[model samples]
Target: MTTPPFDPPSEADIATVSAQLGRPARNVLGIAARCVCGAPTVVATAPRLDDGTPFPTLYYLSHPAATAAMSDLEATQVMPVLQDLLATDETVRDAYRLAHETYLADREGIAVVPEIEGISAGGMPVRVKCLHALAAHSLAAGPGVNPIGDLALAQGDWSPLVCQCVDYNKDRASAGQ
Candidate 1:
């Protein structure tokens, strides 16, 4: 496989991401996708952290709005519906398998961890576990790659085509984070 190009994150990007996540961003390799407002929506992380933790979630959702949207979808019990779609529809299942393959390729392109070799986040190729992880992959890899992710994104309130990020710095200033 050819080595994919990567854009390394800057110090400022790290700081902003830390603020966005309300904690330190660990082993972030690059910004996977950005919002219309220029803030990061998804981040590509290293397969292994500094402490040797094997984190399989390569594309991490960073935007608060997107996270909230996923949370809302999860609250509405959308995973079972999506899981049923995968179970009943061959085309959707095939596409989801492909998405899983693509996700594995992207993660392996960064670094391969033995424990997480066959595992992709968001219960790929089988179940709908985390909409956030799937949606992050959809945002990073674009539409048609992950059908479930795309569907979830379509069903959700937020859209990457439009900016929905809050003014984090301003909010922090007022709340004293």
Candidate 2:
């Protein structure tokens, strides 16, 4: 596999990306957590949109070592790259691929799987789905959204039901229930 440019982001860049994306500080911190944990995948606590739509804001998959090696400065520097990655389909795929490879390399013997568990509210089992499909559907259904739809699909094998679950969560969050 071709090793992509492996530069991490800088702190300022991280702030820039966070501001540009309108993501919360905790989500940014989650990215740092993934880097520090050296795990195959790191999921950010979903963020709410300005209108209070709960959705998977970002997903970082990479070798724990590569992530761990990333300094705060590097993470900042990498923000633009990540923004670009999310902006284009090809770059998103590249980013996912690179992260997956890095994650595998970091955890050689570990078996990591992406999952979505149902959240309970009002005594109802609120189903949840993978973030990738929801992102794809959003990109396709709405114009001017980021072009990370395909990138989301490329990361794993997700089902429509899973996508529906994600959508439900987003809707619930938007509804403020």
Best-performing candidate as measured by lDDT: 1
Model 1 clash pairs are none
In model 2, the runs with Cα more than 4 Å from the true position are: 1-6, 27-128, 131-177
Off by over 4 Å in 1: 1-6, 167-177
- lDDT digits (tens) for residues 61-175 of candidate 1: 9988889899999999989999999999999999999999999999898788999999999999798999999999999999999999999999999999887666545666799
Query: What is the lDDT, from 0 to 100, of the residue 48 in candidate 1?
Result: 93
How displaced is residue 78 in candidate 2, in Å?
31
TM-scores for every candidate against the unseen true structure? 0.93, 0.22
Clashes of each: 0, 18
Estimate the overall C-alpha local distance difference test score of candidate 2: 0.33
